[model samples]
Target chain A: MDPDELEFLGEKSKIMIIPTFNKENIHLISGDLGPFRASLPSQVPLWVATLLKKQKRCKIIPPDWMNVEYLEALKEQEKQTSGFTRMPSDHYMVEAKLLLDCAPDDIPNADEVKVIIKDIWDMRMSKIRSSVTKLVKNSDFYAAVDNLTIMEINSVRPILPHALDNLFRMKHIEQPKPSQNSNVSSFLMSKRASTSFQLSNNEDY
Target chain B: MDLDDTNLEDLNDSNDSEDYVHITPAEVLELMEETWVNEKFAPEILPNKTEVVDIILEQIKSMEVNIKNLSNDDFTKNIYQLEVDKLRFMVTSYLRTRLEKIESYVVHILKEEEKRVEKGESKYLSEQEYKFAQDYSRSMDRYFNKIMNFCPNLTSDTWSSKVIEPNNNSFVFMKSKKTIEGLPIDITNADSDLVDIKSGSRVIICYSSIEELVKNGDVNLI
Candidate 1:
């Protein structure tokens, strides 16, 4: 397998599991976790390992259709523990999840996926930069931060240098053009001329 | 008390009568001699031309004294009073010299009158001519006093109207000159109130409102 393909398969093969300590009702779902694991970046495994270590007595099981309700409960618990109710608008979570549902053999080219992610990230960053510039100009930085949440999401694909450069350039903003009035200078000049005339006349006579 | 005496009774009766003692030219001449006894001076048997000039000069001096004393109070301590005093002095001096000349002329006229009377001439001056002379003298005296005392500065002509455009927002210029002593004073439009400017020893006054000056900023200098 290509190194990139092997990395993709290894990511998909990993699973995240949660356990209930009590044996009175044991619900489980076991499935091919490859695609789901592949959907997450390498950081998800570390999160899963930490969670499992923290709950040592609970069982860790594979998720399947038979235990869908249990999986949902686990997800709810994870959300509560992480204190994150929803993904931010600019996050690529939904798209990543959609990709996860596809079979590994049917996955889009890694480069193609990377391109899509970069395009989305670039677009999102551009919007944020514009909004930030406007807020700063208006002296409304606090309001802007209160209205929008900024977050970081990891991706298995690397962002292109050109796309990164474009996003960085967008941050360097320009001030709006001032309104033009051409006649004011002329009026002032004429006034000055008249004053000089008056002064000179006084000196002459 | 001596009424029993004939001469005293006659004197008392004469004094009580309607007819009073009259002074004749002979008596006047005799009295003049008595007044000038120690001196070789004779009272002019007839009034001389110089005597008339002296009389007029004395009258003018007395009038000036009266006017000066009347205006001595603090209430009269102002530029107007000073001007009045100056005018009075000028007129008095002028009139004194003028009256001297006039007296000589009058003396000549009186001599002619006497000659006409001797010749039994009548109607030397018509009634109208005499009245007109009297009125003219009175008017001259009154005007002399006024001119001497007040010295009022008045303009015989109106100021030229100035037209100004809206954009030309400048001050008005008022040219003032003293009448008695010619002194020029330039007053700008900004100084709208009455301004007293001293040129030499005389004061030139300029009076105008701020509005009028600003409005009439443009004036024909010529």
Candidate 2:
């Protein structure tokens, strides 16, 4: 999956935003948003907050975990742990990236927060790289991938799965009594993990 | 499609019930997003969710109509317009992803659809999709035969044999939606790893091992 697509999914997470304009609740199919009282903070999906922010209608209130100090501690723990440290949220990277991208000014010490988040991401990626190498070389059939976020998982995709699949094909369980025929299945899973559908010709709404 | 039958259904999914209950469009949108991501990741095509999709699309259309009635200078217009655009993006992306899979795995999908029919199972492909697959398969066959005329004995059978199929054995990182005792990891080994996968636990496992669970929505591939 493309990082943008993952970010799209991540945009669904509700976050606090202070709207400058007052309006009745905007009824949307996904959910309702704001009877915006000026300068009063309300929680809305990140996507909504982004558009409002872009239109200069709202100020994004960064999530509590987006703080530099908290992330620095998290990064320290991530480095100390041999295994992947559980992220603050399943879409932590996604939320961080989107929030940071759209409203850097809303966040305090935004620069420091950005640096620490990247550090955490880099550390996690290195861990995933080493772990993947170990998994591919080992005889273990599967590994528990606890704490890996969607973006991290997507990074290893088509490659990791296909590589393991090819290994499985070559091995084909040297022993007997396999329920199904390994020879019958794909020798190599297609490198193309189906392109993310193009949306360039989108109808203006 | 006229899409006039925009009536939404309640939680009671029993086949015999001829009833309609109030279900908010909000809930439907969330379900659609989940289905979209699941379809995007699953190695094989999933059961058709056209009914749910139709309902959501219907809601979007109605929303659009309402937005059109708003005064030109209304500030709320942009918000509604933006929401509609985003919803359309989500739905279209879901559909386009499915279509790509259908085109790539036409032969494989048709074959499995037949097997599923024999077992009296619900179809994975909708009627329109099934037709599309058949037509695609036929056209590919014709193209193959046309090319084969210059070759030394090639047939549709040969073409089918060479079709690139989705590898179900591929590993996927899945978040378990339910706790299953002794879930089988790989059965090739006599003492295959069989561990309890608790609800909300994430793991990397062979798709073939949890294919059934995936279809039943017990796990979501990340």
Candidate 3:
């Protein structure tokens, strides 16, 4: 390969190679494989088991010439990767739950809602079984799930307080006792009763 | 004989009442004038812009003198702690007043500009004037940012204050739990989502994490 192509690959991989001693003979042999190996970090051999699986073109270079640049390149790569990585699933779920609880009135769009549900799902899949069970048993998780489900159901039809109350009661791990302020309850009961009565009348006709 | 009796009777009543009650046209007029004087109408009182500016400048001059005196004082006993506290308070007070003054001045200028615009005068300023205004705003913003960044350090007795203390024996405790043990992790790394489990599992996730989760199928429900 041409030096330009090798340099382009080196830059992309964040690695640089330097030939030593017999530059001509070494360059001729190294040009084929030196750039490829130079493009990888020292840990590449150990971490990447698939390297042996690929067709062998040349011998792997010794570790000494890899130098500080190789280490720095690896560090930069790791930094970039970690900087953009997803937060742990459990943490994301907790954050979503907190946000939803704090501002339930200001419902986020479908996309945002999905993100929260996914975090809960991921937590269920990856977390320790006991921890998962604890989460499943947790009152907050169920409340969040109920709130989300009610919101989803409401997206199709106008939300009735009766439906919301039922959902809350069904899913709530330790449900709070009903209070005297039953404005929402009364409104929902009247509306649902009137609607059902009208439907029955229509069916008889 | 009857007319003379009636006249005599009226005279007697007037004389009796005169000793207990008296009235004069001049005195009534004088009372009316006094009432008018007391209830004198006038326009609503407001400080003139120039007067307000003068008051602020005077207060600033006084503060400058106070700051000068503070700087010159021999605060030897508990000198280090006193100096830092005084300096911080002084700086914060100064910045607050300065910012207020700048804001007021800007408002005044803008109001004038608005009036000019209403009169169909030049709505846009000359290039030089615009540049000057922009530069002033930019400089103020920069100064404000610098002051805000330095505020936490200045106020905290354990952080930058210990460096200037006389004895140098005062142990500067790191308020952040992450730094108390002096772990090998990078300072930037401390800001990452990875919990330092040893440090009580202090978890932090950046905005980027949420964005990524949204991109990936993991957070499809949003």
Identify the candidate with maximal DockQ.
Answer: 2
Tell me the docking grade of candidate 2: acceptable
TM-scores of chain A across the candidates, in order, are 0.27, 0.85, 0.19
> Residues B1-222, candidate 2, lDDT per residue (tens digit)?
122333663233522353435556676677788788888877778887887788777878888899889998887788788878888888898887778788888887899999999999878998888888899989998998888878775554666764457767667778888888887777555567798888998888878888888777788877
Which regions in candidate 1 have their CA more than 4 angstroms from the true location? A1-46, A49-110, A144-149, A152-205, B1-222
TM-score of chain B of 2: 0.88
Under CAPRI classification, how is model 3 graded? Answer: incorrect
* Docking quality (DockQ) for each candidate: 0.00, 0.34, 0.01
Q: What is the TM-score of each candidate against the true structure?
A: 0.16, 0.88, 0.15
Please estimate how well model 1 matches the true structure, expressed as its whole-model Cα lDDT.
0.28
Each prediction's RMSD over C-alphas, in Å, is 53.8, 7.1, 37.1
lDDT string, candidate 2, A133-186, tens digits: 999989566787888988898889878876776676556544443443332333
Write model 3 residue lDDT over B1-222, tens digit each, in one string: 011233334434544733424323223222222222111110010111222222233333443444455444422112223323433333343333333323323323344556867998653333443445456656655665667676774433222211110111111101112222323222223342232223212221121222222222122211
**Distance (Å) between predicted and true CA of A184, model 1?**
47
Best by TM-score: 2
Could you arrange the candidates by DockQ from highest to lowest?
A: 2, 3, 1
Error of 2 at B36 (Å): 1.3
Model 1, residue A38: C-alpha shift (Å): 17
lDDT of 1 by residue, A131-156 (tens): 44553354311110211222321121
lDDT of 2: 0.78
After superposition, candidate 3 runs with Cα above 4 Å error: A1-34, A37-51, A54-127, A142-169, A172-205, B1-222
